[model samples]
Target: MPLRKADVVDEALRFIDSEGLDQLTMRKLGAALNVQGGALYRHFPNKEALLDAMADKIVEGIGDPLPDTAWFDQVRILGNRLRTALLSRRDGARVMAGTFSPGANTVIGTDKAVQVLSRAGLPPAQAGWVSFALFYYVLGHAIEEQAQLGLPPDHDWRERTGRLAVEVSPQYAAALDSLSGTDPAERFDYGLNVFVEGLRRLQEKERAAQEHAAR
Candidate 1:
């Protein structure tokens, strides 16, 4: 049977979910699929290429582009949707964050997101930046969840990983605590609302400024 793009990504996702990102490799994926190890090379060209395709598929699921929703509504929905998609696959968030997609689905979703901001009266450039901001928020939340998902019952890794990092700021430590010690799905929703609410404030300020300037 010919290896379909969907089949290839599905196999890769299944492997990721079951084995974790640490164990995934092209050779491992092929063996899992019961195909000659070299056969994957024919379809994917390289591991990086396969990862890109996987990222694309994952990102494409960021929600079927919503053009008619309110600004906060669109951002909130995309944030939640993207987080769920990444959590669905092993290291999906990490891989997608490491890669950028100029592919069709990603671009279309991005364009539609900006369109919502534009309709809310932001200039084109600001809207574009906000679109990226929303994606970054989603990616950041998802990647953090991946790292802390399966804490040992004794919580050894939890204590170690939760220790304040040298690079992480003290001011952010409280926020960091919120990032762990809870269900990722709930945390994802919380962080997503923060970003959307922040955007809502900015949008209101912008609207007020625009109105004031006209007065």
Candidate 2:
């Protein structure tokens, strides 16, 4: 059977799921696909290109944005969906960290979110910046979640954190202790809510300022 680019990328993702991002190489991926390493080059050109394709595939789970949604809901939905997709594969976040496709799918998804914000009255540039910030927040949180997966479930980090917090200042230790045992999902939602709320206030402020200038 002849090899196709999609076939190579799909097999590569399965290889990473079993072996992890660190273990992925064209030579190894080709071996998994029952072909020579050189065969992958015809499809990917290099390992970086393959990783970029994998990153794009990870975001495909977001699908197209729904039509006529509130700007805040669009941001929240996309952010949550991106995190879920990254969590679906082993070391998926690490694989996607610096890779972006810049193709039709990625561009359309991103532009749609930014357009939502723009329609909410933010300047186009600010809307774009907010969209990028949401992307970064999702990527950073996913990476942290995946990295923590390697630690023993029962291992206690509280003592270590407490000691470091005390060294910073008494007030810092007290604040850190207050947040102990907070659910990860709750923390994610808390930060996300803060971001969207902050954006709302910012848009309101901008509108007020523009009105003042016009009056």
Candidate 3:
């Protein structure tokens, strides 16, 4: 079979999954694809372009948002879907952390999010800004989650924190203890809810001000 652009991306993702993102190189991907390193440059000008494609592939896998849901639910669903996609492959979050793809899937997903917010009564500018804010929150959370996953199996954050907390003030220890039993998913949901609730309040306030001004 002949090599294609999609072929290169698929193999690159596979390479990242098995060997981690830091280990992926054009030469290695080319070797795996059984072609010369120069061959990939035909599809992607450089490794950064390949990473962007891989990030787009991750977004592409998120499919579509649910139908007829409340804007808040829709936002939550998008955040969860993004997180799930990022966690699907090893170092997946790391692969997407700083890369932005103007790829179709990425643009479509972003547009949908902005549309949802705009429909919920936010101005287009605010909606777009909120969309990017939500994206960064999810990406940042996923990056931290993936980094933790990379740690040794027995690594216990609380246990480690407890040891250091004792040396710090009691208030610091108490604050750290607040995170005691919650898993990453729970923490993610809590943060997402907080963000959505804030957006809801802002929308309501804006609507109220608009109504007042019209009187």
**Which candidate comes out best when scored by lDDT?**
3
Q: lDDT by residue for model 3 over 1-215, one digit each (tens)?
A: 77899999999999988999999999999999999999999999989999999988988845485779798889999888889988888888888885855678888888988898988988899889999899899999998888877778777656797676556677775666555446889899999999999988988898999999999
User: Candidate 2, 17: how far from true, in Å?
Assistant: 1.3
Scored by Cα lDDT, where does model 2 land? 0.80
Give the runs in model 3 whose Cα sits over 4 Å from its true position.
61-65, 156-167, 174-180
Give the candidate number with the greatest TM-score.
3
Report the CA-based lDDT of candidate 1 relative to the real structure: 0.77
Q: Judged by lDDT relative to the true structure, which candidate is superior, 1 or 2? A: 2
TM-scores for all predictions: 0.81, 0.88, 0.90
lDDT of 2 by residue, 93-211 (tens): 99888675555556766787787788888778988988899888988888887887776766455577756654566776565554445666677788899999898888789889999
**How many residue pairs in model 2 have overlapping backbones?**
0
Q: Of 2 and 3, which scores higher on lDDT?
A: 3
- Whole-model lDDT, candidate 3? 0.86
lDDT of each: 0.77, 0.80, 0.86
